[model samples]
Target chain A: MPSTEYRPPRPFSRIYVEDAARDHPETARVLRRFSRSRTVPISHYKDIFNRPRQEWRAQKESPALILAARHGEFLYDASAYTPTFGHKRFHYNALALNCVYDCAYCYLQGMFPSAHIVLFVNIEDYFAATEAALAEGPLYLALSYDTDLPALEHIIPYTRRWIEFTRTRPGLTVEIRTKSASFNRFADITPTDNAVLAWTLSPASVAARYEAKTPPPAQRLRAAAKALEAGWRVRLCIDPVLRVPGWENAYTALVDEIAEALDAGKLEDVSLGVFRINRDYLKHMKRRAAPTDVLYHPYEKRSALATYTAEEHKSMTSLLRSCFARHIPADRIHIV
Target chain B: MIILHTALAAEARPLIRRLGLKPGPGAPAPRLMVGDGTALVVSGTGRVRAAAAVAAAWTRLDATGHAPSAILNTGLCGAADSGRHPRGSVFVINACTDTTCGRRYYPDILLRHSLPEAGLHTFDKVIHSPEEARSGVRTAPELVDMEAAGVFEAGTLFLPASHVHALKIVGDALTDARFVTAADVESLIDDAIESITAFAAALRAFAASSEKSGRVLDESEERALGEAMDALRLTATQRARLSAAARHYRLLHDAPPSPVLAAFAARPPKSKNERAQALDRLLHALNGV
Candidate 1:
């Protein structure tokens, strides 16, 4: 049976603030938000985030918050694994190091050593770095690669700030992807042409089985519909489509449901990709995480990457594309 | 198994008696007591000795194939401020600092416990006065001990940070380390015996329930797996792939892949090509092709 158990979001019981970032305005604001949580001071966020022998499962159950100031290297070139949506200059930055939702296929589980959420309080620095890069040419930046900024909008107005910032910078375009359904947080903001609110919508069965602590697909569709009605450039991501049993029927039903709920012509684009990960990251994840069908899949390992065999990938992508092509134009469907 | 480490024998005596632990036959260096799935080690004074004792005891206990799941460091400590944490008050340490090296270790407290929590400072030398205590530690030292940092450093090497804990009983006022008599130390531990045993039990339960399930094969199936491997005559890479495939099969079906391998076990491959084909067929079957 699908899990109908209602899980109230677990609050951070403890907050670790870096000594240098203790007096930052963002840190102070977050402290005010979680006023009741115990605050511990640390020399650096790495002291806790990179600690040895950290139990990722236990920490994920009740994750703590670490606020620190990022010093250098705020922007990184986008990897081939992530689709760029036809952008020439694609880069991503991590305002937060870890995510709030615990998807079974999330690569962050293997990328970071600790499960604690580390929020960098220096947003102005990231903005300045982006502005510096935009001087040469047009830039497309991914602001929510390592975390769901929209889910954490209540904690800090990062998504709103980035959206407002992107409105004036004609050479800059930003993509903020999330599994959150809380669109009311941006009710007051003006819709922007350069900012894209990408929502990852999975099949109900896949979401129930693999995506933990995320809003249901129905709610996510409602949020996407609201965004589309508000004249925002919204992207529907059916990416990382899992090849579970009866996946074709599940994905077809999902596509039909989405078509019934929202107008397909208004969407900016639809992104599609099969599940894949770094081979080393999969090894680390398998060592630390409990057994799950997704993690334990015998993926075809090839040159630092682990993914389904070509035949399986072909079969999954073809099934999804044929169904999605019914509503969305073939030109608007991007296969990463 | 839950293993307890104490700096002094007096500190360990109360737990040994309360938990009904007896002398465990192993190495005689650290002096181990074991019974009822619990073990206690009397690590001598100082951080170095405590670290060495914990490492030694863990190695010895793990050699028997029944490895410890959790480790608890229980001992008496000096309260930096007597008014705040009075004599005989027990506390669960949330973080510990080593004064000599300025290194810190935070124990992930995931289990539920009723004891009050405090930060600890493990100093090499005892603080003789309030001034010494204030200057010796980097910050306000609520609880002062000599083995907490050492215990955490060594214990985490064997288990996860969540499974390593420290419970301290305040016995002095940060004036002198040797001020408390052996009887006084014993009484301090005796006063907190209930809390210690309860916390240990919670740790043991957490460790027991947190063990990963649905492994590729169990103890009873190891011999059969070995025989199958021999029958298939797989190379190193093929063997690893088979093991991974078996794990995936077990996760998907909640049953071992021995039944799938049983088909190939009776027929040995005559040539390298035949062996490769056999491996491919077994792998495809295990992978749910």
Candidate 2:
């Protein structure tokens, strides 16, 4: 086995600022926060973020910050991979492109060409669009679709800002899903009834092996317990459950831990999913990312999707649902 | 592979000597020096010359099937504030701009280095005084050069922006017009040689690691798989499917799936139907049936 040496996470040594976004308040805030970092100016974020031949692994090693004012589309219909939680009008936004945490199974590695975080500084435009979409009917918005907003709260309090935005909008329900234990970022603010603080919890073994730089399951559960105590609508996500060697035991232990740590009766719901990705994205990921067992699995290809065979998917999901059902009611378990 | 471009022979001499580079066969235009997995090109002092030399050197190396993984363009530069950025001080450029077109290129500096970071402006004409530097360069760059933009533009044509870099050693303050000699330029680069080589080594290692990670099959496994396809006389579609299956199997098992092809050695498939049936069995075996 290769020797495991601990290396600290790379710093965001450079911040690319768009010419038009230089005067934005959020831009100024980020610049002030990372004052010691080098600031490079560009006309658009795509110049750096969407460049071809960018080494995805290298950029992930030391991701830079690209702050640009978004001029075009802000909201998109949630992709098939995301579960809408039975919401009829579901939408997502790219307030930030790319994520800080580098999970091996993340589809962002294939969806995006670079790992540099491109933060849309013109957040008010996204709010305006969301409000416009809300005018049509009730909207279930996934705020952290492309990124983990809570993980980046220290850099820019986008999670807090989104929670604040959702407080007044009665017909809009937003889900800020994360693998972060950063509930303390917005601890002082009152929890909004419409905003859901969803945490994706994985087995400790899985977390340590596959999820790089993400908080462990115990820390996430502690954060969820704090949210539940503060009357926040906290949801537990056991999502993209990999079919590792001992997945059954790992997930059962995870469910038991979740039950012991927090009151499942007061929990909002449990989201369960098998590991599935776009077929093309999986190809791109295999071509770019390091060799890992998860990407090497012989998945069943159906059209543009790559996932486990139907029998395998059913077996994995059934095992988890059975394990989780003992703590949470069967009605509250959602599988996507 | 690593490729280093310098604007003058004086700038390249110290590096060639320090890195133990030898001259290429016969003579090449714009002077090419070679070492283990590294080559240096001494282009004359100008943007056009620098860009052309990089392209020519890259083409020659690529033709030999040893394309560079990283390109470093290092040479002497001028900084207006000499006290803050004194002569002989080196900097890793974070961004470079072309004053002629007002176009800027930002090289992703992902590696860790102790040298100070600075933005560079590539000018068409030399800056004789600080007044000209202030008027012409709008980005307030700390270092001024003549080939950074050209080098970046050419290097990025073949490699990613992350793999392209520019290191500048301050040769003088912006006040001097023609005072610095070739010896002075050589000394400046020689002083910062360690940092330059260290950065280059880091880039090469990073690229090598990435290449290793992205590789689905080793050379021997690839050869074995290729020979199996020829033996099977598979169609184009079948060849593609078999190749994908072999890669998937190798990724899972850490060994090539070509050994399974030995079953057909005694009685090779004779018809299209037989080949299809054999391929299905082979794929099923590779997929862990």
Candidate 3:
């Protein structure tokens, strides 16, 4: 059985700085925060991050920090499987590579070869690329795709900068989705309608069992409520729902708790998705996260996608749709 | 299993006596000494012998279906300065460079041991003179040894860099290298046996934890999932997913119901989507969701 004992966050003992990024102001600022850590200079972040024989599971226990400059393409269209929420143009950017939170079912376990977080110090490059894309036409972008930017707001403050940047750009719609409870960073800033603070919510029990180091559902809901009151467009995501034992009761209680906490009319929308993963990612996760119940569940695979049976997906999504429909309008819910 | 490699019998003697390892009868070259879930190999001296010995030990272990979870190279080394790091002080070799090939190997410092750490230079010959030691010092080596790089290279061939470790006890200073004797090497390693033993235990624990993370499916569960997939005539990807789903189902629930298996057996899924739908239903039913 997996241990339930709380493990404190392991600080980065080493920080790798890329030669191209070493002179940047952001790099200097981040380095100052980790003065005690031993700094190792490298030609590129991949020298250490992509080295052979790295134990992803073990490294997650104490991940190092990689400060690198992103030189190539910074943005890409969202994959077909990712829900676009009825947007005509949907895209995502990788400002950072890996996440700090260790969710058991996170696709990152397979997507990334290493668990170390790579924060591209040059945020201007990403903004420039997005602005260039917006020059052609309006764009809908997910800011925190590969990593949780809001959770690391205290470190990088990318979310705050993105919000400020979005204030000037009229054609750009930015979505910052996170499972973090660090919402106080938005207290001083004026909320923008174009910037949506999407909060990923799971049942308290599910979060406790599978989402390691993430804030509990109650805490996330409170953050979401705070965002709504701050005039920010907030999206509630009850996503990748696992079929854990007594899931119906667990989800029912979660929906009821969310309904009681926030103003239903204020939510931008609720996105519903049952547990699904890339087939290749599921294979890798199964090997790495063998002890976790959510990862081992028998899933159906179609066109490289692994998810619950179609019937199970329908029943679970329908059940949650009905539960959510009681409090909010049915048209506001998007199922994936 | 933990595999300990040493350059000399003297260096291995202290560990053998402390760990209660007995010489295995008819053991192959490299002198295998076996204990409870642990083995020690005397690699003689020089980098070539050390590398050969590690390969031999790994091969023997593999033949017996016992791959080493962790490999540790422990021996005496010449300190850059006796005044700085006193004789008999143990230092973990974080980086190993072979002077002959100019190839550097880094051992992952994953475990937090009690001993201090330093860079190691593996030289073909002993640095007897102060001038030679100074030349070695120009490379910024803290410790000088004969077999650390060789051991590290061979260890990585079988185990990951994280699973390989090197601990060097300062046997002599550059000025005192020629004066040192085999008895001094034995005494130096003997002096640090307590710390070495603790380090060995920690390495074992690390290896155990790593193994626990990459666990395979149980045999019975694997069989059940295979049977279910075969009945459905699913594609390769479908079979893999169905197996994962079955494993997930078993993880959350106590057991898989025979009725579900019988139902699946009676009317097998004909199409890929049908197979996926059936598998998903099976998991939900097993999880009682």
Candidate 4:
């Protein structure tokens, strides 16, 4: 269906999900294959006994897990970051894609054909590949390309797995990018010094509206607080800060929540980015969400992208930096 | 019979599966597909590597246990300019002239085939758009790819011109930059599989239909074969004589090489004006005046 055409969420009784442990066993388990029209024969459920299972059991199918199908062997991928705004990022890879949760602004929806989650079950292959790549030089790996880990933590348990995996590989660090505040799960697990638990945050109201199927902002903060309390390194992301109504209050309230739960000392860095896309994506969003003021903004063409006007991006980032700098140091706050 | 060959077996398996085929019957590495006459060869992904594959298949077919009557090169291709052609489509190059070596050849064409002639292009790197795609269209090479040269080169060693052809699906736009989606590209594979099936069926039907017409070759068949040899950049008369030698003379013996053609091949005689001057030079030499 055209993204402009509202697709009622699909629910499937059974579908095939590919995820395995023993590769990046430190990573969360990926479960896919349930959607609106597709169904799995009950025999398939019994056949599950034939395969191993992991913790990340994302429930929503079709627009849920098992997003699309692909035919190829080794994925020809390498670290690709913007040439200009080269964030202090060494490298990246596709560990997982099109998260289990459905956030409105997610790029996966436009990228993937099927909304079905595709958990590449061959964890060993990915691990061997990642480990071999890391052996070449010191680098950082970005995890949770599509969804937050903690939410699927109960099922996939990917972030915790990465924490464990990274500890074994020297000169390797990981940034588990996510919005889920399910940090309590790691309270008992040993925290890795090489791991940076980056918590993706949006204002409370934005989370409530756009971040459906995701934990509330407070819950994510609680998770961040637990990661801090557990002596784990941390980073904060105030990315894609939507210019919703009461934008200032929403962000201010979010800062207050973080201050209460997360201590400044525990954070390695903080990133504040205004909401943006490649503009073409916004066209679909505009059609999908008609008459939504947030969809239609005075974005400019920068680097062939429809981004916040220079002034808008500058103001949003500056305001967010100021908000956090009041509680932290200027060095700790970063903007991209 | 859809014969897909690659230097790599592992890479070809996924493509075969996507075509709704399963490795059938054979125990260790079964090339046999009981479901359909779809033969996939995993030629390693490269020029020299795939060239070896095409050669090996031709070798195997000649005086071997299993031999195929026809061949089709199938796989993904990076479009030089994919933005102009978003959906994956078929490319049929009637003639291919490589500018690097100044070698020209007509690749075998499946006539009246249901495919589009999108022109030719070259890729130094993975091309994603027309702006980035090599300007091969002016010469009108319907599609430009790495493996086709190997396929055409090897197919000529054995198969009749009617028995060989090259086809590809636009996997990525070949251009200066890259703009592609795996999800989008794979869907083109699906479309490719559909057309490939239809083309395979039509060719097979034609071949079967031709058998009923007896062993007497048709005039178009003779001309098509001649065109292929011409694309090989052989002089027209030389191509005709050589094709006749293969068809009627059956002369496998080494024939004396042509000195005049050899001299022209060595220097190409430059442009038409330069060649005209060369002709005068040649006439003076011939007349000894």
Candidate 5:
């Protein structure tokens, strides 16, 4: 039998201590998981989490009761910022971090120090914080941008809480996004008009390669179908279209399957984008990724975004927009 | 192609038959490239053996000067939780964990989220309950196979940054002499073959690009990696600590620890039987589980 050896914990960007007043008491609770290991000489760590920047003051920083944060109570700002496309005018909140699935191409590779998940149970506090920050009415919030809130329903049931919280405020609309097939968790919940569910999907081929930790694409679609039937508004996100030899056919097949699963008339929206990362994250990506040319291409610098060249971005986005529009209204489409 | 990790040769004979080939007489030195790109090497279920097995596989590829895009550690992992777990379910691991101690790993391909996450972890011990399995998950390992981490490390020896795609099937969770049954073993093996076969095919089919990068040990790349480490604020002390850790890895790669090798060399195999046994052991260890 092989002996178990210690592998150094991956690098961390920053750490936040859960102050007594914070929203999520659970954030600090999970960080101490290793405290028991301190008794062993080899297991002791200098600091449970890296606290490089408690206050850079240059970077936008906030610390509350982080219920649970991915990658050691650290969240990357500007690592990802999506502009709501179509009828959804909202921003995604990665307040809780890391999904239950460990997909190969997941952006978490560059975002976290460890794979252990951290959820900020004080999510309601984040909602309160969001409400306080938003002077506008009816602002849509993406709940599971960095993690799957619904999948954890079997465990943490955070998404259920979010739904209840959203139901209280008519001005607050939520979009619970997921790639999980754990649809049974929400099979019985009555849908709220203010709550929109966006399912991030990839082609079967993509699932076979990079989506190893994810439920099969069809399973996710089946979940989406159930949600739509339960009277939930659904959006299809095929962003980060990974480049494979036959991406055209693969995406076509994905859309076809999704279209089959959901009555196209009830399909709320669809958004798609080619895979691209900001240049800063490109550094982190290089350190931990597998062999692939899809990510290493020279990106174009546009509006401080490192992505495909103008023509490539425009054409690709336009192509995807049309591909998605073929199944849903163009007004319902959003590019994130 | 299917990957097998059982130590039982008599049972393995049936697998060989399924592949329409006879089991090689008495476990010959684990062959490389026996079935083209799909090679079978014994990765005895543990960390050290798995690492060694991985290294041996790399040595074969290293001699040819070609590296495989994927390295998989296929095996049976036991835990006493059949009531909760369907026997044949397959999982690809995210970390190789030592559940006895809570050591965990973040594989080269880091999952964006935690569930929907499948990874094979090489563990020295077996977990016997849903609670034990949950603890394994809490340790941050998705799948608890025996040897993928070592195999991944061995691949790292050659590529220094190769990623291992590992998977495991549930075998006997806790099979005692009386508790163990051929029916149990066959069920696990069948599930293993199906899952591994699907896993290999899935990798081939799912060609995807996420913005993942591999840093070469080369100077420029090293600087980039170092800068990333710095951005992550690996404290200067931490940097030095990592340096010391890197030193050990370097020593292992370029040179074998002398005293141990000398002892093995001194007692070289004298007969073909001894050689075969020695080679099998070495080959098995090469898998590094």
Candidate 6:
């Protein structure tokens, strides 16, 4: 039976402000939105966030907010586990730390000690750093590495800023991946070929079981369809395919649903991969999310990456690739 | 169990009466009170007494084989300014610094509470003059207490920092020190008992939820596994992986003594390499590696 208990939105009750960012215009703008929340000042963001003995599980129940001025390097080369999608200069930026949506399989659970969202209210700094990096060579920057930026469009318009910033710079390709269904934010703006709005699609069964508080798969497909209709380069990410019970039927139906809902011809690309996580991160996740089936998989560790055994990986990947081949051209499908 | 520490009898009197606690028999040196799943200790003033009282209370609770789930220090404090927060206003101490030792401690504010939070300065001597309170304000502490830092430091020795909490009621502002009487101290704490009770209940709920979420193995099981793995002469990495694999198996199947693990445990490996090989084989069998 479905639960009918009413749950109020768990918005942040406190916003920790870094001393340097207290006077920043972006800080003022963000604070204006959450004027009711209590403001606490700190010398650095880490003082509150990186403190020892933090209850990651309890904090995740209702995460607080933190605003800070990001110092030093803003971009980093993509991790070996992350696929570059054939881009030679593939890099990622963390304008924010941690994500808004809580997926049981998300690596952020292991990567961060605290679940509170930290938004570096210094977009100009990140842009300046990106411009400097781009001056040397062509850049393929994934702007939503640590966060689902588009999901926070109502709070911060970094996605819109990235779209506007990419328009002026040549040889700059940006990918903003999200599971958020808020695609109307891009309706008024003209789509740029250099920008990609990647939507992570999952089987409805898998999403319902693992992806908590995320938009349903059907809504995500509709949003992807809307983005394509807006002339935006839309990519479908079927990565992290979970092997739930009756997964084959679920994924097959998911492919059929995608074919019926979206124009596969207009898709920029389709990326496929099975469930995998950094070995260290899996350790952190196991302690907090022990009841989660997807996280409890006996995974094989290869060079610091924990994934299913070779046979399981091959079986799931091959099955997904064959399913994609039925609708999209094989050449357009990239398996990572 | 929730353990609450206070520096004076006047400070703990209202809570004891409200929570319906009786005089505890154990720990004769520092007066202890017990009721329900909570205990209260009255430590005399000063950092030394506070730290010693916390240690004694923890030892007594440990002797009873019941570790405290949460530790809280609730008492009266001198506020920097009366205009900002008048007497009887309760404040949650988020950070505490010892003026004598110059060391700082931060209590985890993971759980939500009804009282507003502020930083606290723990001075060896009470701040009486307005000039001293103004000087304390320059140090950036909203409230001045005598034992919060000591209580926090000692509580963290036995419990996680996240489970340690410190709450203070403004007994008097520096400007009002001359007019404040002993009756005022008890009355101020008495007035804030409702908020304190709510805070205690919230802490208990948080501790319960934390235990539910932290379903890492029981202490006995973890220790047994560690000893068994040590007997096999496994490397640190191998031990960690095998532990994770065991936890994964237990979570997925909701069953203990996995067949593959049992097989390995029945015939212990003779060498480190053999232990590593056994682990790999077990993980492969369990995880389909």
Point to the candidate with the largest TM-score: 1
- Higher DockQ: candidate 4 or 5? 5
Worst 10 residues of 4 chain B by lDDT: B248-257
| DockQ of candidate 5 against the true complex | 0.04
What's the number of clashes in each of the models?
Answer: 0, 0, 6, 61, 60, 0
State the lDDT of candidate 3 residue by residue for B108-131, as single tens digits: 555655567777889898887445
lDDT of 1 by residue, A1-336 (tens): 011222212457788899889999999999999997767888899988997767777677778899999998989999889998888899999999888898989898888888889999999999999999999899999999999999888888899999989999999999999999999998789999999999999999999988999999999999999999999999989878888878888999999999999998789999999999999999888866655778878888889999999999999889888888888899899987
Off by over 4 Å in 6: A1-9, B23-27, B97-106, B136-139, B216-289
lDDT of 6 by residue, A1-336 (tens): 011221212567778888889999989988899888877776678877886667777667677788999998989999877778899999999988988788989998888888888999989999999999989999999999899999888878899999999998998999999999988887888999889999999998888878888999999999999999889999999978887768789888988899999888779889988888888888787665425756767666798898877998888888888888888888888888
Q: Whose TM-score is higher: candidate 1's or candidate 3's?
A: 1
True contacts kept of each: 0.34, 0.34, 0.39, 0.00, 0.07, 0.29
Q: Candidate 4: list runs displaced more than 4 Å.
A: A1-12, A17-64, A67-89, A287-292, B1-289
Q: Flag the better candidate by lDDT, 2 or 4.
A: 2
**What overall lDDT goes with each candidate model?**
0.85, 0.85, 0.81, 0.53, 0.52, 0.81
Listed in order, each prediction's TM-score against the native is 0.93, 0.90, 0.82, 0.45, 0.47, 0.87
For residues B91-131, what per-residue lDDT tens digits would candidate 6 score against the true structure?
A: 98877888776676766677765567888888888787556
Error of 1 at B264 (Å): 3.6
Docking class of 6: acceptable
Candidate 2 Cα errors over 4 Å, as ranges? A1-9, A135-137, A246-253, A325-329, B227-231, B250-278
Candidate with maximal lDDT: 1
DockQ of each: 0.36, 0.36, 0.28, 0.01, 0.04, 0.29
Candidate 5 C-alpha lDDT tens digits along A37-106: 2111111121222222111110111111123323232222223446554323456576555556656556
B5-57: candidate 1 lDDT, tens digit per residue: 99999998888777788888687778988887888899899998888888888
Task: List candidate 5 stretches off by more than 4 Å.
Answer: A1-81, A86-89, A134-136, A301-303, B1-289
Point out where model 1 deviates above 4 Å.
A1-11, B176-179, B213-227, B254-256
lDDT tens digits by residue: candidate 4, A229-288: 888888888878876657888888888888888687568788777766765666544333
lDDT digits (tens) for residues A1-336 of candidate 2:
011222212568789999989999999999999998888888788889888888787778778899999887888898988788889999899889988998999998888988899898888999999999889988999989999988888888888988889999999999999999978887898989999999999999999988998988899999999999999999999988988777889999999999999999899999999989998888888777666667867688988899989999999999999988888889899999
